[model samples]
Target chain A: MPKEKKIRVLIAKVGCDIHERGALTLLTTFRDEGMEAIYTGRYQTPKGVANAAVSEDVDVIALSDHTGSLPIIAEAVLAELKKLGVTDMPIIAGGLLTQEDVKVLERMGVTGNYGPGTPMDVILTHIRNVAC
Target chain B: MEVFLHNLTGIPRVDEAISLMKARNIRGLTRAISIVENYEEGRDALLNDAFQRASEACFTLGFTGAPGVGKSTLVNAVIRHYRRSGKTVGVMAVDPTSPFSGGAVLGDRIRMQEHNPDNGVYIRSLASRKALGGLSEATKYALYLYKAFGFDVIIVETLGVGQDEIDVARYVDVTTVLLVPGYGDTIQMAKAGIMEIADLFVINKSDRPGADLLKKQVQNILYMKAEKERPPVLNTIADQNEGIDDVMEAIAEVRQRKALQGQERHRKRIVEEIRSSVLTRLAGDAEPHLDEMAGKVLTLSMTPIEAAELIIRRIQKGCLEDDEKNSI
Candidate 1:
């Protein structure tokens, strides 16, 4: 059998909201796909996400936020990444997102937005297409 | 003296640095690690030289949780227990940095000061530097430095509550998630992502109200999930050093299990390091072009999707270059 090099990814939940089932699901999915997945757990600031991204040296960064405040949180994180000169990293966000919220994240330069109930396979595909 | 001081500010040549580290020249190694962590100019040259000098002696343990969860006190108690067993310990207490001044509060050390004068104990307080995960970028190098110094155990304490602290679990051999009873609802514990990553659950301030109920709740939840294994829950009053030995025993047992299974936590850490290094390099390479890319997107000269595609391509190119270099 060929040795598999797991593509590393960091999955984090940003902001004050503590919901993480979706984030955990993503972590599981990434690992199932033979990816080395490190989950940052919950209540991450944008800097925390970026730092995890940098330190974990992830191929992609997937953020899960079920709370409705994704716009402000996304902006805060993306802005911090920009300030830190890490704007090259791909960021994909998921959670209980509205269509409008998806639009906002898209404009903010997120790779893609996955709303609630999106299949794990679908999220995985997006992650690979954008991050790998 | 000037050369020594310069080496203190600069990265040391590897053999000299490693010899110094083995000699437990804490100031020299600490300065070297600080330079690496800060990515100070010319630090890379020093790190390359020192990288092989350290002995990789210790297993790293990361303890993390919300503020007021008694993480510092718990770490102190755990360190004290380890010291009793005649183990040499290194502690890195990560504190939050003031956003305005870029200085740290360094509060985690205050609770752990009792162990300050012990030769067996080495404690260093680090400011988060606004980096995510409440860990300094130079953490890996610092671990190597400690390992070179012959420490058997390295414990990293996080700044505050959240995902960054949880991420520490990935790097350490065993991660203990600390919970303070009555901070929030039982649902908060479940929601915090600590449920999945923590190898052991520490209910600090067990003397507090609802400690038993919280323990039962966690146990029941663990049973319901019925995963491969359930993390053991221990009650502790860290302030009083109660139940600390049991916690240490649990840690030792887990370490034994991990060793018996032939699982190299260091291998996982190395993989993480490679990934982090590659991504950081890719990101660093692409950073210089962001303004150009952003300008194209903002001026309507390039569509957002196209701009993103271009950036991704550039990052991928960088990764490819890194891969080729590593292979050679």
Candidate 2:
């Protein structure tokens, strides 16, 4: 029998963004929702997150950027993923983002622009749909 | 940069995957491990090929200890030492699966992320998946694939464990147990499970108080076993990379002296593997009928033992019928 597929998500932080509260919250939520969450901790480079996502074969790349480097970090992560030949890898961004930042990330094909105050259920539902 | 095998529609044929893996295609290796880990179709065949390609060149080392005991940090340090010697390394780090959600946060990679850019090292995190021994079933199979790819050293780090959970010892060449000050005292050290299996013991965070006392306590235990070569107990501040060289030297010494015994252990491991596979098969076959068996016992139609016997008999009969049909 084929085993049930569990949605694997890689939650990471890039650059000097030492903030972990948002990233850790998402990790806990993923686990509670029955998704395999791989946390890379803080101080990751954009390339580091991409390499990890590929190695882990995660279903989604969740970038936590409270440093407001969301657009730049998300762009780098996407570029890195593209360089790795993973054009279709889903990228999601969350954290203290302005509307302008969200628009920029979405233009780059990143989805789930979740900022603080986004309900847990909403985030979970979006991932379930995107991961499939 | 290569596309992952799973990203493609169907599972690749064993030969196709094997060739890609032989060429050191990281994506192919990752996908092959996933196949074995998830027990997908063609898993056994893939593993058969992997086992045939395995050689003794890849040395597997295991690191196990309690939670927050610096297992991952020590593993990171060891990987650095191995890389400095220009050796390729593969690491399989196991973390506990949440029994309720059936999910896990595989955070061991966090400590070892410095090697993320280094192609010479591969780190895969495994959730224990309810395996009581603090290891996942996929670990041994993943080792086969890692060996086939020709890593110079393979490391298996078990989830933070308590006094027992010595299963990692059965799968690796050397089992290094890490202890910290205040973890336990003399009687805790004398416990028969985790402490007894170590070919080497490391007192990590040795900069803390009570480190020397812990080392002496471990030595006292080793002294009781006069006939055997005493496993060395070393001190280290793993995060700072202090005393790591001594640990590496001790591992080499243990490996060299235990060469003959290693062969014997390998043979026993083969038997254990086969036994586990068969048991898993039987358990899978038995699962579907368990509810009915329980119902019968609840109704008092049969005792639990009788119900168990009936289920076994039915399974045997079904197997015999299948064999007869195949023969015809």
The candidate that wins on DockQ is 2
Prediction RMSDs, each to the true structure = 17.9, 2.6
DockQ of each: 0.01, 0.53
The residue ranges of model 1 lying beyond 4 angstroms of the native Cα positions read A1-132, B1-16, B41-57, B98-101, B163-165, B224-228, B295-305, B312-328
Q: Tell me the native contact fraction for each prediction.
A: 0.00, 0.54
Q: Give the per-residue lDDT of model 2 (tens digit) for A23-43.
A: 888888888888889998889
lDDT of 1 by residue, B1-328 (tens): 0101112322245455545555565545654554555565556666665556555546778888788899989998888887877887878777665555443334454576556435467666565654566565556556665665667788988778664345577677778888878756657656756567788889999998999988888787788655546778899999998998899888877776666534566677778778766665565566677789889988999997898789889878877999999999
Evaluate model 2 with DockQ and give the value: 0.53
Q: Per-residue lDDT for A85-124 in model 1, tens only?
A: 4566788887778889889889888856878777877877
